[model samples]
Target: MSEIQKALVVHAEEAERIGLPHGGGFRLLADGRDTGGALGANRLSLGEGAAGARPHFHALSTELFHVLDGVVRFTLDGVTSIVAAGGLVSVPPGTPHSFGAAPGSAAELLVVLTPGVDRFGYFRALGRIQHGLGTFDDLLPASEQDRYDVHFV
Candidate 1:
């Protein structure tokens, strides 16, 4: 007899929230291990003018973002675009990208990474850096960044 895999569910109120220094935050829904390495998911809330992420790329994962509220500005390669609520953007592996809440606009987003890389720790470290508990240099090592699949350009 085959064993049945249980479903994974995270209620909004129960999600782990990681607060950023600039009024932005991340609500962690699922990590790669929880999904058997299939995907990782999270919700990001950014206050007006909040920086989301600096230029980076995943060498092995594709990232998807769904704008749930307000507007977001995304830079792919060297082109920048404004994505309003309800917009979706898919970034393939190796594509350099960055994002932030559009100037003067707060934003909410659902973010997913496929072929999941365990990235919750990466997010946590980022939060710590933002809060002055850690330094960006901590994540600057190639081995450290590779562990989370984020390669800064």
Candidate 2:
């Protein structure tokens, strides 16, 4: 069967927002369906010391980050740097990378994943764990490899 395509629109108030465990909020802008698996986007707001994803890589997708406010500390291939507001960075598929809000400052950014992965469940599970509704181990089942394709490096 062929898939149908349609434009997706999301206003500020329409974003699906999720609070992170440590200190951050994520607003999902577009999912794989909306972009026809081409890309997905989320707006992230993190306080100082907020924990971001661990060092990992997407085997089949590129991750891009655009700093909208404050600074973010990004560790890419063992090198770390503070990306100030308005700065942009892109991690090619298979690159080892991690990121978080700067130690003494907060940050806001727009994160995009190209060749999108179906990660809404991952995002929701993260919020549930942060809110004490689920355990960290519950975030990733043995079948997660098939579901999200996340590779920890």
Candidate 3:
């Protein structure tokens, strides 16, 4: 018999949420291991004026963001743009980018990393730092970030 494939389903109430320092949060949907390395996914909810992500790039995967609510501001390679709900952005590997809620607005986004990297640990680490249980420096080492494919510039 051949290997069996199973579907993965994450109900809204069942997703794990990770809180960020600025009142935002991440609802993890699936990690690489859960999807057999096809993709990792999460829903990011940003408070008004909250920073979603600082400038960074992935060396091994393309990151895609689909705006699920409100407006978001994105800085891609130093250029800034405003994306409203329903907008989608795909950043290729090695391209520097960052994002946040538009000033005075709250935003929600569905984020996906293709050719997936197991990023749940990174998200959990961020939550730890946000909660004062860990330091940002803990994630600065190459061994730490490399495992998630996220590189800070």
Note the Cα lDDT for every prediction shown: 0.94, 0.85, 0.93
Scored by Cα lDDT, where does model 2 land?
Answer: 0.85
Candidate 1, residues 44-87, lDDT tens digits: the string is 99999898999999999999999999999999998999999999
lDDT tens digits, residue span 14-79, model 2: 999998755688898988778899898899888887877888888888999999999899999899
lDDT of 1 at 129: 91
For residues 1-153, what per-residue lDDT tens digits would candidate 3 score against the true structure?
A: 854657999999999999887778999999998888889999999999888888999999999999999999999999999999999999999999999999999999999999987999999998898889998899899998798899998
How much lDDT does candidate 3 score?
Answer: 0.93
Question: Residue 123 CA error for candidate 2 (Å)?
Answer: 0.8
* Better structure of 1 and 2 per lDDT: 1
Output the lDDT of residue 111, model 3.
98
Alpha carbon deviation, residue 113, candidate 2 (Å): 0.2
Better of 1 and 2 by TM-score: 1
Question: What's the lDDT for residue 70 in model 1?
Answer: 92
The residue pairs found clashing in candidate 1 are: none
Clashing pairs in 3: none
